[model samples]
Target: MISRISALIAAVACAATLAVSPLVAHAQDQQASAASAAPAEQTAAPVAEAAAPAAAAATEKKDNPYSLGNIIAHGNTVDQAVLVILAIMSMGSWYILFIRLWDTAKLNKEAKEVRASFFKKASLQEGLKSLSETGAFRYIAQTGVDASEHHEGALTENIDHNTWVTMNIDRAVGEVNSRLQGGLGFLATVGSTSPFIGLFGTVWGILQALTQIGVAGQASIDKVAGPVGAALIMTAIGLAVAVPAVLGYNWLVNRNKAVMSQVRAFAADLHGVLMGNRKVAGR
Candidate 1:
């Protein structure tokens, strides 16, 4: 009887153990799934965060208020006209600067050639031939020669050969100088006036801005900043146009002085040759 009672207790305990084991295994599986999903959730969070900045950048690009397009679009007719005038002035200044630079370079090159070959020639005719036909030195030499040869003309008879030759040489030098100085005035004008023109634009822009502010009855940064910035851009443009023009003008003027010195020296030597003081050949 004791053995049968023991056997019945063992069977009941085994059934209970079998039922609890399955529940414990299911709980373990659920915990394992949750642990694996947590890492994936954390990794996905960083990806979402990185994408947000790119979206914001796109939004900012679309709303840029200070771009040139916005300036032109919001500007008045007079403001646009001022910009146009500034552009035209800038264009003219650059054109003159480049053209003058090219002319100066050409003249300097011709001057060098004259120094190297002209004085080495056997006679005045040979020297003239050696020089570039379009050169200022050749022109001055020809003028002096003509004055010496044509001293008998009624218009020139009152002047002695020396005075006549000097006058002709001086006149020729003046002509060359005038040609070299052709665009300098325009450059000066642009440099002096561009800033004022820009200031005019600024004034006009500010007046308009003020008018709008008065109408809007508000002084917020958003309302005042855009127009004010656009107006200031005119001043900046003017200065941009002026500074280069001024610099180019000064540079060209200095270079002109150097080139003219060479020219005057050539004219003086030619004058001496015409006066029979300096022989063309070494003999």
Candidate 2:
């Protein structure tokens, strides 16, 4: 009976050991699963944060404002160098236009006054005095009289007199022509070079655009449009400045030609008066 009791006790102990072993193994499995999943959760957190910024950036990119109106309104569009060139061209054009207009008008009025004074019974000395009130026409008439006074002689005795008079007349006319051509050459130069200067700005802007694309790692419209639009603004400004300069140059040139024609006619009329119809061989 004692042996039977001992065997039963041993069997009970063995059953308890087997049940406790399974419980401990289940707890270890749960711990292992939690440890493994912890690393995965930590890794996913950073990925989610990184993805969030990218999504926000994409949204912002969609709302980019590089339009013409936006650029103009902001006054953030044009390059400074391009702006300077445009301003210079514009101011120069207006300056030339105003200066030449006044100069031409004065010249015309003075010439008409000189003609009237001569026709209204002014002697040579009186006519010169009347012309002397204005410098431009005065210089012209004085040049002819000076030339005639310097070369006073008979035709056979003074062969060089005609040549001297012609030279002095040409010199005075050339001086007047120089005044007429003033500022026009600069206008032409501005017209010719403005496009090239703007083209340089455009190229520089394109280079900047490429740099931005490289940094952003994508070539979206937002990434490219800003620089391109800014670049085009420079080009357009250049053309806007250039067109007026070119037109001004052409207009001034034609007006100069007209003024020079009047000068030549005045010189011829003076030559006829001073030398007489028979004395002046080439009327």
Candidate 3:
């Protein structure tokens, strides 16, 4: 009976060990699967982090409607007209600036040529020949010569030779000054008024924005700020248009003064030449 009981206990212990081995193997398999999944999760976390910011940026760009392209595309008729006027004013201002700058440069170049070539000649007739046909210097020289030669004319018979020639030469210088002053008024107008034009656009935009916001009854920051902010861009653009025009106007005015001074000096020298056989100052 004791031997039979010992055999039965051995059989039960073997069955328990067999059941426990499968559970241990299953636990180890699960632990290995978890370890592999952890590495994959670590790699995926960095990729997800990078993708999140990119997705956010795309959403922001999609939501925002204040880009220049959008302003032009989605703008109302008044907004479009204001933009057009500002554009035209800006373009016209630059065009006038460039053209006036070119004119100033030509005047300066002619002044130099007069000093080098016209003043070096021995006689007034030879000096006149040295100047350009269309140049300010030649015009002055011809006016003085014509006045000296035609002293008997009804317009100038009462005036003496010296006085008549001087008057003609001075008038020529004044004409040159008038020519130099051309287009400067436009620049002044643009500079003084462009900011107001832009402000007009901004104010109109604000009015529209407010009207819409009032009708919608959505006074929240997101709703109010976006349209108002977009409206302010018109003011910025107006200022941008105005600043260069103002600066260019000032610069051209100063340069014009310098040019006119040189012209007056040349006129004085020419007057002396007509009256006497005086040597030109620079030569």
Q: What's the lDDT for residue 70 in model 3? A: 69
CA RMSD per model (angstroms):
5.4, 15.8, 7.1
Angstrom error of the Cα, residue 280, model 1: value is 11
What lDDT tens digits, residue by residue, belong to model 3 across residues 154-272? 86687877788888888998998888888889889999998999999888878877887898898777566656766798899999999999999999999999998999999998888
Q: Write the per-residue lDDT of candidate 1 for residues 49-74, one digit (tens) a residue.
A: 99999889877857456555776786
Candidate 2 runs further than 4 Å off: 1-78, 152-159, 277-283
Per-candidate count of clashing residue pairs (backbone under 3 Å): 0, 0, 0
lDDT of each: 0.86, 0.78, 0.86
Clashing pairs in 3: none
Enumerate residue pairs that collide in model 2. Answer: none
Per-prediction TM-score to the true structure, in the order listed = 0.75, 0.66, 0.73
| Residue 64 shift from truth in candidate 2, angstroms | 11
Specify the poorest-scoring 10-residue window by lDDT in model 1. Answer: 274-283
